[model samples]
Target: MKKHEGLNCDDCVEHLYTYLDGELTGETESDVRVHIEGCGDCFGHFEFERTFLRFLEARAKAQCAPEPLRRRIFKEVLLDNGSEAE
Candidate 1:
């Protein structure tokens, strides 16, 4: 792994989300990637976050509510707010 001359644990943690989401620019991404590779703790945190995002993605794909269920929820929300679902 190439060493990121100025990257450190704090910087890596600060940009973890952006890094995982592929929102970082090329240079920033490289720095964060290198930092994570050399820092065990940061790497573990990155892995955990990555796994969590994947789990959420899979769960969302698998558990989409049907149209009827969505309508029911919308009606329920309207009723809960004292507005009838006409």
Candidate 2:
């Protein structure tokens, strides 16, 4: 482990999302990277969060509805709105 530097656990928590998202740049980014690598708790939290984010990203991808099914849904909507689907 290297020096703790200016970032404590609290600072690490605050920067967690931004750091993981690759949004942090320059020294701030370097500091958080170093802190996570050096601190066991922070490293574990980073690992868990990164995994969860990957899971969410995988499940959250938009899939287009099939055109026939989409038209059926639109027809239902038009009927409910008192407009005939011609």
Candidate 3:
């Protein structure tokens, strides 16, 4: 990818987060991918961001099941209150 024609690092940085989140589509996504693969600096930034995202995801997993349990408890409380209102 040519620096003059393809996305330069400055342009690619704007899309990096969106790219990591799988929010970018089609040509824009393709352009970022190509630029990251070819540019070491951009690739480094991508790696750091990707690793940080993985860390966040790992931390979030611990709380994932608790949200469902909390929701179920709240629903049950609501149902009990509804029965009392009958």
lDDT of 2: 0.86
Per-candidate TM-score against the hidden true structure: 0.66, 0.67, 0.71
**Local distance difference test scores for all models:** 0.85, 0.86, 0.89
- Where in model 2 is the C-alpha error above 4 Å? 1-4, 62-86
lDDT of 3: 0.89
Task: Give the TM-score (vs. native) of candidate 3.
Answer: 0.71
C-alpha positional error of residue 30 in candidate 2 after TM-score superposition, expressed in Å? 0.2
Query: Which of candidates 1 and 2 is the stronger one according to lDDT?
Result: 2
List candidate 1 stretches off by more than 4 Å. 1-4, 64-86
Candidate 2 residue 55 Cα shift, in angstroms, is: 0.5
Candidate 2 has its poorest 10 consecutive residues by lDDT at 77-86
For residue 17, give model 1's deviation from the true position in Å: 0.7
- Give lDDT: candidate 2, residue 71: 87
How should the candidates be ordered by lDDT, best one leading? 3, 2, 1
**Candidate number of the best TM-score:** 3
- For all predictions, the C-alpha RMSD in Å is 6.7, 6.2, 4.0
